[model samples]
Target: MGRSPCCEKDGLKKGPWMPEEDQKLLAYIEQHGHGCWRSLPAKAGLQRCRKSCCLRDRQVKNSLAS
Candidate 1:
């Protein structure tokens, strides 16, 4: 059988991120630079999986640079 989807496994959150979640991620990334997307959510106290974090990082990275 095919492996289960990562988002569906382990009860990891899936869907739009909350404002507080974004703020938490932004602050974490700003302070720690998101060294590894795969390991970032736990470090940042997020319920989302790494892919969600990765996408959010992409969205904010450019703005953060400005």
Candidate 2:
């Protein structure tokens, strides 16, 4: 059988995140810490998946390196 989707794709945001999204994610993480990626989107009020959040975090970290 095919792998199940990590999260519902409907209405979920894809591609690069906006500045406000970055702020929301960062703020949520700061306030609650990284509890669970799977649940973080709903908690953070973002329309992304756990993997997307992780990638966004990684992207932020990489950007900071330069």
Question: How far is 11's C-alpha from truth in model 2 (Å)?
Answer: 1.1
| Least well predicted 10-residue stretch by lDDT in candidate 1 | 3-12
Please, what are the lDDT tens digits per residue for candidate 1 over residues 1-66? 998766885768888878899999989988998699888999999999888888888887777788
**What value of lDDT does candidate 1 attain over all alpha carbons?**
0.86
Query: By summed lDDT, which 10 consecutive residues of candidate 2 come out lowest?
Result: 6-15
How many residue pairs collide in each prediction?
A: 0, 0
